[model samples]
Target: MIKEKKVSSRFIYFFGAFGGILFGYDIGVMTGALPFLQQDWNIENAAVIGWITSSIMLGAIIGGALAGQLSDRLGRRKMILIAAVIFVIGSILSGIAPPNGHYFLIAARIFLGMAVGAASALVPAYMSEMAPAHLRGRLSGINQTMIVSGMLLSYIVDYLLSGLPATMAWRLMLTMAAVPALILFFGVLKLPESPRFLIKNNKLDEARRVLSYLRPKETLESEINQIQEAAEQEKLASQNTSWGSLLSSKYRYLLIAGVGVAAFQQFQGANAIFYYIPMIVENATGTAASTALMWPIIQGIILVLGSLLFLVIADKFKRRTLLTLGGTVMGLSFILPAILQKVIPDANPMMIVVFLSIYVAFYSFTWAPLTWVIIGEIFPLMIRGRASGVASSFNWIGSFLVGLMFPIMIATISQEAVFAIFGVICLLGVAFVRIRVPETRGYTLEEIESMEESRQAKQKSALLERAGL
Candidate 1:
């Protein structure tokens, strides 16, 4: 019975990670498909291509802004179901989009962006809420892994379909997401609602029942107690929380920190590579566009492998240390390509591939997964939805900027300069994280919240005493 219960808990977590897989697939599928899209659509300029590429991110920005309020009102499960539906619609529209109607394709991409945005916010929160505290890191990390896996699968699918007729090929690639979207919708049906959502809704008994399925049987009672305590804390905190209150000094710093991390994650040039790999590869190798399209697959593979390796060490290492190291490695990776381009102007294509692969490897293991893990865990539950949404909004905004600008930047500036700029951004990330980000590894969410509140209370009291209030 114990073994069965343990297996059941594992299965639940696996299904939860599946949601992330869909998120990754949606984000990555368009990378390879874009080259074919531009040619088929008769796109003539970098600015136009950039706008088309970033249309989804613009929709995502709106979706992310709305996600918190909707999820809080509708419950995580329901919001995810809605997102799945939107994903299906977007996939179908994109697959059969009018051949010459670029605007229609943009509209479809925008719809898909909305689904991606909602899922991005909800999935990690759901996974974190459902996971046992001790195992939360690993379980949440699985979401990142699944995201990479989905990306890898997208690349493989694109590579395989690359030789097919362009119209059918791109359509098939975009529509492949429907398979995972359907799987996520059905998988979520069987999955229990997040225990936190239930507690927040005043369904304490239901929360406990859900906890039974989420935690191992032996740990169920203790998990329930932890949830009850956290709920009580949240209730007390709620008395002081409102949208307006978040702007005050007490909460302002946390909000800034959250948004900073989110913005920094994207501004570090991760999406530049993700959105423009084929172009980067073409610039580096002087390869034909068709051959350059496969480069993102190499990136996807390295991302999967690196993230898996990171999972092993994440628990053992300090989170800040890992993030710093990742930033440094990423910065160096960017510099190497620039150096090769300058010095060896005629460097081997394989060397360029090797260097780019190393860059992806560094990003996947460290910055990519850890940023989401830390963001999901750091904020208090009472304001988590809003705070996370705010942060995610910044993230998507940065994604939009990078996606919209990278192509133009690469066109105007040398590719070496583009990479050099990213390297500098990464170095700045290391400095910011080292100074501002706190280590939260091995700490429970409740404990972290308590610590933050305690500090806030002390600061508030100090100000009152000074003002003679």
Candidate 2:
């Protein structure tokens, strides 16, 4: 037996979760840079502005789909390196994009977005594969923490660099992504290929080698065998089912629940509310939007704090309990504003801000991070990659539509009414979780897969009886 090594799991886990930093940086950097870019280019079209801001999400949708399939075929490590390289190239290209070359910048942002999407999908799964059963939730939760930290980093950089000449200001902000990208590329080179991937490819000895480092010596052999058996079962399951079966009744309900939650999370307009917060505050408070300038930093802090709370409590509580509680609170936060607006027509706009702040804190503690945690561990191993991609795609689609439509939505309907709609969506989110979603917080991925398969078998039996087949 190979001797057990005492490596800092922290180093491995942090490197694995490093991709989240890139994801968050790309997301937050644009928020600050967009204003300068608009002034420099003298752009007046709202559609153009929206396109520039949302191109990343659009690229993410395409990237999520491609990364899912590629990670499965090419291996997780290779795909991560590929994403880092793409981030570097996209950042350099975007920073140097010439004045009046909006299309070029959009393309580069989309290119960077591809990396963001891939990282978003890959990090959770990759971290999930390497983490011990007891630590999985915390490790996966760390990925979210990294993402939030990156956003805060970008926000700080943007505020500090605001005094620079506008031309150079945004360029530096856009190109700053290359720093983390390079770090990620070099860092991943030192990590092992996922042991699960090695097992799936029939590299048994190599899988053992990886697990020897990943697991304690005492549990190493058993862990390898457990993963190996899971891989074999997945292969057999894949052989027995075609992709078409997923589209058919065999897996329809599973897809509906997974993909539905994914989409609903985004569609409830969290991002819309966030992206337009300054404007929203302006309307409510009857004050200059600049008064809210310090607020993004505040919100970013909340996001970071919320993610930290998740890391601490992730393994401690029941997933459904926290989710249900968070959803109910998030719904009420928005709905109460509408009720107040109707009841007290002249209610102070600061009240709206207060409720929104509450919403943000609750969201940080619940839906924002948990959405990723659930999707990361919930899918069966056989189609985990593809199904994750689908759910991710659904998420980006919701993001894209909401980003593109929210301004129009506000114009067509008053902002209060628009927020009311989001409130209703929140309640619906609660129903999905309470009734349809399963709890998988403490279970191993293989065990979760087995449980889902057993559930599917029962569903099939019920369908056959109902059809008299």
Candidate 3:
């Protein structure tokens, strides 16, 4: 038997999930900083402002793809370290951009977005691989909790800094992301590599040592055997580990479910509410910018509180069931306000805020966290990194389009119409979950993979029988 230092499970969970904090902070910080930046730069063009806001997502698209491939080669922990370094660099550059440097700021945010995208892809896989199957959903769900907490932190920071000089306030808000990035960097240095990754790399002794600490003593050997078997099967069956292999019949369903869940989560437009809530509130209620800014804090609070609730139900509930219910409620929340406006013709503007709160409440506990949870659980180990990158890229693509277009869409169409469109997408998301996604709750990663094989075998047997073979 090989010996290794035992790492704290709590520390592993906290730091493994900590990347979400930076991801959430960068995303939320811009919401508060955008108005100040636009004013200080004397920028009146909505499209230009939209580009500045959405540019990080464009970079995230690249970051997810790059990190996914790199992590598969370098290990998940190393990729996270690289991402933290990039986040620090990006945050500092964003803070120091000179006057009328909107282009520079956009470039910096795009650079920062690369880190955010990498974290978005890396954290779920890391947490999933580290966690016991029984606790994987809740353990993976911790990343979501950290994300909302970071957003809440950013909103609070924005409020505290808003009273400063416009130039100084936004800079501080943007640079604050570096603080957590540094923390994550230091903490991750001591984290053990994922046992599953170790097994795949032919580091069986290291895998066993890591698993000894991660799994119960009585079951540790059995767990090691399961992972070792899975790794061997994958090595034998997969001749090519390229991205193209994901398109084969064996993996096609997993890809559709993984990528579709990821894509739809953003397409439903939660970030539109997050990135632009202040603007949306100001437009609807005719409130001063300062008062409008307070709304995000409220939304942030609801999000954090709701995310806490998910830690309770994550393992107990079926993935598809929570998704279906949350999507239904979210769809109705958006659609109801539109209908109320049409019927009443002058519904209380605060009614829009109330509906948005409801939407956030449902989303925080449901789709927001569960998307990562399901994606983390569903993919096979051989392609988990590349497939996750593909899913994360699709997610960021939707987020980028939604972030860039919400302003433009609202300008050309009625706000009511735009929200109505999001409502329709949310309902469509529910249908997608019901028809395409599988239930992976209460199953080990090895068991889930085997379930897929059994499913494909049944389908093949049925077809052969029908042909009288």
Better of 2 and 3 by lDDT: 3
Off by over 4 Å in 3: 1-7, 195-199, 202-226, 240-254, 379-386, 442-469
- Model 3 steric clash pairs: none
lDDT by residue (1-469, candidate 1, tens digit) is 1222222666666767887888888888888888787767767688878887888899888777777678878899899899999989999898999887788988999999999888877887787887767676586567788988988888888888889877778889999889989998887776767778887788777777777665568987777677778778767767767777667765666676677878888998888888778877777667655567678887888888888998898788888898889899888887787787778877675665576567788888888888778877777676775677678778899999999899899889887778789889989998988876767888877787677778789989999999999
Residues 1-469, candidate 2: write the lDDT tens digits: 5543434667778787678888888888766676677667877576676777788889898888888779989999899999999999999999999988989988988888899889887877788898887776476567778888888787777777777777888789899989999999998877778888888888888778777777778999888888878777877867876666656654565566678778878877777755556557766777644345456677788889998988788768888888888888888988899899999998787787788777888888788878777877777665665576678788999888777677667657777888878888988998998877878877877776567678889988999999999
lDDT (Cα, tens digit) per residue for candidate 3, span 1-469: 4345689888988887678887888889988888787667877677887898999999998888788678879999999999999999999999999998888988998999899888887887798788887776466567788889889889998988899888888888899889999999999988888888888888988888887887778998888888888777767646557778898887888889999999999999899999988878877887755446788899999999999999888778798899999999999998998999989987788898799899999999999988888887899877776787788778889999999999888888878788889999999999999988888888876788787788899999999999999
What lDDT score belongs to each candidate, Candidate 1 first? 0.80, 0.79, 0.87
How high a TM-score does candidate 3 get?
Answer: 0.88
- Number of the top candidate by lDDT? 3
Model 2 residue pairs with clashes: none
Model 1 segments beyond 4 Å from truth? 1-7, 214-222, 243-253, 349-351, 380-385, 442-469
Candidate 2 has an lDDT of: 0.79
Pairing residues by index, what is the TM-score of model 1?
0.88
Q: Estimate each model's TM-score.
A: 0.88, 0.86, 0.88
| Residue pair clashes in candidate 1 | none
RMSD (Å) of each candidate, 1 decimal: 4.4, 3.9, 3.7
